[model samples]
Target: MNKKIAASLASIVALSTLAAACGTPADTGTKTGGDATQAPAQKVKLTVWHNYSGDDLRAKAVRGQIDKFKAAHPEVELDAQAIPPDGYRQRLKTVAAANEMPDVFFTNSGSMIKEFYDGGLIQSIMPLLNKQTEWKNNFTPGAFDPLSFNNEVYAVPVNASVTSLFFYNKTLFEQNGVKVPKTWDELLAAVKTFKDKGITPISLGNKAAWLAQSSILSSLANRVTGTDWFLKAVKQDGAKFTDPEFVQALGLMKGLADAGAFQQGFNSLDNTQMEQYFISGKAAMMIDGAWALTNMAATGTKEQLDQIDVTVLPSVPGGKGDPNTISGGAGGGFAVSKKPTGKQLDAALELIYTISGPDGMKAVAEANQIVNYKMDVDQSKVTSLFYKAYNLTKSVTFTPVYDAYLSSQGAEAINNGLQELLMGGKPEDIAKKLQDAQAKSIGK
Candidate 1:
């Protein structure tokens, strides 16, 4: 969380408490059940805020699950709203300002989760999960670690994601006589091969800026400075962004750009356009988040889809990082409100469990999206691309992306500075810019 955002939320929450209550009042009086000691099963009406507003496969799958959940629990009314994807944090902040936080909502696992937990805005679902042991065991090992703070889990793993990946068109590669690259030199050679054949070597949509940071630099940084150094720098423990290892990481990105490795005017292209280029076979390869598999499935042709595959960014020879490592983690999930009472809390917990559990994961798998849960999914029903991505993730040592590890301001600065670096800016200068932003961010 950014310090400014935290402070603003604190003030708003404080003020909102004076004029408004956190949640609706519900009757918890005794009702009919096997156990008379239990409170009445009051009806719960929950507002779920999420970012699946678009008509994509993930959204469709989520809506399908929500319908199933509704069918299973007819008494519960879930008013789910699809929030706009852009600047969602600002909208959340505004809602928090009014003390109208949703009963349950989608939240990422990093700084936002920590700040929400620290501010008493969200509650730990560990106790609920512990009680539901079967459901608890359905998550992949270490999946909950990102959502856990001080050994206590606060959120349920919903969407397990690996952000840094080389999504390539296998058809293009084979047609052009290019093989999947395993090392820096091989990757460069492939880039040259594609470039010489008048095909765009790689499609990068850096206009959004974070795409560069999340898709390329995040993994490259890991390959250069290693995860330990990056984590230490995130904590401001004497590891500076301007360090040689970090500078070298920036240099690698610039080198690729200079080599015409990416589509021309890539810095001006948004992620959507870049995806267009790749899906249409105008670009041979693209580096993107694992979540892109869903987009690819929805937008690509059967032939194109069959030819799609993924790999981790190739190793940089003599780099501190392992070639088997990649940038990834538990990206986002669901967290219940700390203030919901009576059946609202129960229903919210159930919603999280059902949506993030094995059944929900199966649905996600059916949609060709990777769910974070540990479950056996029928791979035959999904595309081969999904299996390739799954194997790629399982093989790599995961590292959190810079945005996930840094404060909002620091993360934004990194995205912007890296964009400048991609546009012919010096690595040292961008490194200093990132260092300065990180200084102020950590200080705050």
Candidate 2:
């Protein structure tokens, strides 16, 4: 696995030797002069884990930040493991169970963060956060809300994202005389218009099975039932996933597929293929995470970048939910494990601050990715397209992505059921399946 165990062992040995040579058996102090000579800072070794192994720009930016942090803190021994994103959650949970988690690790600000917090696997970041008011204020307002539990924050959110944005080709929309839809009916009309022109209205690649559920259905559910119903259903406070409103959200997914909104054989294609389809102009629009803005900038030509515009999904007609609400929260960031003392704790905290602080966020933004830190970038240095998409978060109300608030098992069931729904499963059936999963998650 090349998990960097050797580096850690070497660090432990070095630290042990240093500890053994300290003052006296009982002194425990490193000071050695009559004038209270200060000893050198104790050696600190920290293991950091993150889901950023690929050559994608996001991963590259993280790697760059780690390099900078290391260069700036030569006294701290930082062992970082960039695990593949696919297996990240499983690995995190496994290590967490063993109580041998890395000193610092990247995690989303959602259910898993709460799970870790409740299990005492993660620690509150307030100690360092309180001392750095300027750093804390650098985050966008409410960005840390999801990472909080029982009035204490557990992680520093690095990236902000909205999961329900529909990015469309402006040229295609203009050519087809189709305006960006502002409401449910207008959206369907635009879909019909594109269909009439023999153009695919949407490109969806759901082979991963999560794009439809987490990216699409999550937004639709928020549009139909709002955050209140979702919370009620998730908490089992008399509301249920099987409630008619929730089922109706499922039905909406079926209706879109039935209406031929997606490209043919979409279920067979993966997210990368869908991005290709959209960039190639084979599809008029794509529904995806706002984080895709970076990918688009990195891979798309200038013409394509100029033609792309992002907007929230249209509102559901006659639904209780607010149309302006979008499914998303603060994106993944670093969390400190409950373990670590003295210098180890200091190193972990420093790493978090260095990665998510203004300096780190500025470097991240320069890489064309959005950051949660509140700073206005120098416009001339970045593409205007990037700024356009980054500003989209301000207009919409944010809600948690479906899987973000659900347990792993609950999320898996929802994703599976949605894929089935795309293949002609009934909404009621899918709703019941999800309800069953939710019940199991809560031990009911």
Give the number of the best model, judged by lDDT.
2
Candidate 1 vs. true structure, TM-score: 0.86
lDDT of each: 0.81, 0.82
- Residue 73 CA displacement from its true place in model 2, Å: 2.5
Clashing pairs in 1: none
Report, for all candidates in order, the number of backbone clashes.
0, 0
The CA lDDT at 393 in model 1 is 75
> Can you write out model 1's per-residue Cα lDDT over 397-443, one digit (the tens) per residue?
88778888788778878888987887789999988888888789779
lDDT of 2: 0.82
Cα deviation of 250, candidate 1, in Å: 0.6
TM-score of each: 0.86, 0.88
Error of 1 at 300 (Å): 1.5
lDDT by residue for model 2 (118-208), tens: 7889888898899889889878878888888887888888787567777888999999899999887788888889988999999899987
